[model samples]
Target: MTLYQKLKASGNPQAVAQITISLLESHSVKETAKILGVTPRWVYKLRERFRLSNGDISACIKKRGPKFRMPNRTPEHIENLVVTLAKETNLGSKRLALFIKNTFNIQLSPFTIRNIRRRYGIHCRKHKTLTGSRRFATDFSAFEPLQLWQIDAKHIADQSALPPEAYASIFKNKLPPFQFTAIDIKTRLRFIAYADSLDFKNGLTFMLLVAAWLRAFGVKHQLFFQTDNGAEFGGSAGSRKRKLIQKLIFDHWNVSLLNIPERNKETNCFVERSHRTDDEEFYALNLKKVTSRTSFLKMAQNWILYFNYRRPHFGKNMNGMTPVEALKFYRCFYHPAIGSMPVVVLDQLSNYTSLLFDISSLPWDNLPRNKKLLNETMAHYRHSIFSTSL
Candidate 1:
């Protein structure tokens, strides 16, 4: 077979371009077209392109389709927005699509978003599967807001996840080293506090503050706070300190502090999962912006507010609702301020001697009548002591 016939069978663009260039040089357009088993019009078009490219062989190759972009193609700006959101949130295609629609009022299919992610080599990290037996098969789907909360402490000074500037700033500015996180399993409402250390006192203080904040916001249900058996949280079974702290929380707020089984992370999965998000969305992005402990708390407060009031959660049973929205959807009665609860420094709160004394001495029998007093007291600390310290 001839060169054209050989290449026509394979349909190689480079080979066709080379053959077209060579044949056009030695033969007329019609003769070249006849030899190449193509139309004279095609030969004429190739010759014009070749001449325009100064006899470049690549210019002679016919593209597989139209030269112009498809009319249905996503806009460049939209693609750029998608990429920006992908890097910022690291969310999956479906979640990303939902966010775009909700935030920007733009509609995009998940498949289109997935294609954009694939094209840009962006990928969401895959989490490891839980292999060991779960301690409880309890379905949390039926749980209501404040009925179940998962609390955990996460070290925020991770060198690997933080940028060098942020890592240096952590020590330079004496920023809090640990973050105490609490998430309501039902609405995914989260609260956070920072601490200089992960000691038992700080942990107990954090739990009490979270409980007080919840109760202040009309969360009157019996709250269950689940946590891993960390030393800060009273340690494993048979530990005296753990029992003491548990009793303190139970006595103060009627909150039940349940310790998850040792070595099984899946039990406290909600709070544990929130840690990864904290690393990705909060610490990694905002740490460098923190010039002082005050600034860090401000940023932390804003971040938690954004998470609860604005950011959409697409997790199981959440259905693309923000925590605040989820509360409303579930018909759970809660104050809107619950979503914007003040972020406090645990060490500061723990060390406030008079405040601690007041909390401990407050009459539990008259709690209903003292609700306004309790709210005023905490608000005073948040505005006066916490503000001054910051």
Candidate 2:
């Protein structure tokens, strides 16, 4: 039979693929197309499509009609039951179909139930499944500052309505809404940077900034950066930015990168909890204030300061102290393995320095003269008297 007759009889993409393969083995594209009664361009297109789809024969098929539909033979009462269970209990299609079979003595396929739910726009209905997740205490945060850091980014809605500028093409302005975040596990001290976009490149940039900031505090212990297995973090495709990070941050600074299990947020519990706090306190309160990209960024920086230095963290470890307070606690105490640092005071300007840290990053430059120096003689020598409160 002719090639057209063969394709018409089989009426399957696989058949087309098989015939194409046979023809290509013995003939050129032009000859194959001539034999098939189609243009040579069509043959080349099919070849490319096959290559891109990795020779999946089904890729050659013409797409057929109608994605979703409730079966016509299904009774109206069964359809109603599917919708009712979906809305009330949020049972899945199979379970709902089984319920219909048992209670109403009606046999409804899961497909029929799924189609019925889809018809009423309830197909995406979800109910919580029993999981092993629970609130639990962990001893993983016993390290000194910079020994461990958790990094992650959260996305907010883009509220900007303005159009692009004329010179914005080469360096075009399109700001994506993302809040790149990092936290010291032991101190609960955090770093949050707002950015217009978030990708692997942006993630690496945030890490560099965070490391530099941490270095300024003299907390330059070899650190482990824990993050989820996101494409941006773990790296994917052509530009494996994670590899570059391994060479730059990990190799250079003696830091390491770690990935928690896929979809296992609990493994990266500290950052996840901080994100919840941001949702409750930051985003919910300031969403309306984010009129422009610039304004939103300023607001985000303020929130980060409040979170790290002002807002108290609750835990036995934290002792109702803010993150900076917790850091002071750690600097005086706590070791990686042996536990608790020596309280060796070299009698530097720590009193003035620590006070400077508390004055807020932005306002420190504009602070009154009296606040910058030791107005009072604060002693920390061995002979110096110590005071404590119960």
Candidate 3:
């Protein structure tokens, strides 16, 4: 039979391999058996011996070449490549693999890359499944915006560690600078700022700043300020700094101060969420190292602006409006008579418009000046004013 008929009858490459060995035995029993690593009797039992096909016997033989130790890329090299990609792209392994192949001429399987990255501590989700029953201290989703705010402080590096000197300093004094942040649960707007020191003075200053921000937004509703039991937030110590925040909330707006259990930062998860958002958006972004306090403050201000005005929050309670828009709407509700007038009518109140008051982002130092002016104005309007409180 022709090699075509032989190949067709063989069924597949394995059959071809076995038959080819059997046919070679008739040419030289010892040599064929040695090459095929089989007994001559076994080769003869196949019933086709010394039968060389006229055409393409070489094609039926397996192709020969040096196979790669790693067909695509080494696991070590792929791991290094994935880490580099994650730091640069902040993307998952599948997209990162495609990017590496397209951008760097390196090929890697997504599954392998994912395992490598996860082994190296790259993960998007913050929480993992619990093996035991998990207990929640509070129902976080129970309230709307302006009802509650979660506050916390996270430590960050003063500057990026570069190399030998940086590595040395990191080992010697590894603690990062402090960033105090607050998140309005209802609106999900993050108010973040940094300070040189996280002492009592700075803590009080932070509360004052927050109070000023709330005043600027003209939020009149009572609020609940939740915080972890940090010394800065006046844990069981009942420090003056803690009292200041409480006093400001109680005296100014009648807001409540609620402290999370000691060491249980998750109870105030909204603040942690804000911190994570800052880490992903600002810390992970390619920015110059914060060399000076001034530079850090500037970057922080920019981040807060983005948080308040630009970020598209996942929470749908805000009617698709950003935090700034929600603040504006909240102000309208706080003063319905003035807000009831159409913008065109209120446009005439341009100079004296109640809406002119900023409800957020106000500087703390300016609040006292505002209060003094407000008192004087209220005295002037006392005879004509109809309301009990201004």
Best by TM-score: 1
Looking at model 1, the pairs that clash are: 234-242
Q: For every model in order, what is the number of clashing pairs?
A: 1, 4, 7
- Which ranges of candidate 2 are over 4 A from the true structure? 1-132, 135-137, 158-175, 236-244, 332-390
By TM-score, the candidates rank as 1, 3, 2
For candidate 2, the lDDT comes to 0.61
The list of candidate 3 runs beyond 4 A from truth reads 1-142, 158-176, 237-249, 287-291, 315-390
Off by over 4 Å in 1: 1-56, 64-91, 120-138, 353-390
Least accurate 10 contiguous residues by lDDT in model 3? 338-347
TM-score of each: 0.72, 0.45, 0.48
- lDDT tens per residue, model 3, 1-390: 645246547657556455555556466755655555567664453334224443443434444565555565456766786787787667666656766776889877778778777768886532222335343454546865556878777765534322333323422443235677777776676666555456544454455456556665576666777777666666643555456546544566566778776766667766775665665566545233555444555666666776676554545456446676675665534432211111111112222322433313333232565898899888878855756554
Of 1 and 3, the candidate ranking higher by lDDT = 1
Residue by residue across 1-390, what tens digits does model 1's lDDT show? 765678867856678777888887789999998998888898788778888999787767766777898899899999999999998777888888998998899999999999989889999753333345554455866677668999999887877766677678888889889999999887899999888888877887888888878888788878888888898877875676666555654666788778887778888878877887877777767787888888988888889999999888888788889999988898986778878878888888897734654445533232477889999999987899777888
lDDT of 2 at 48: 78
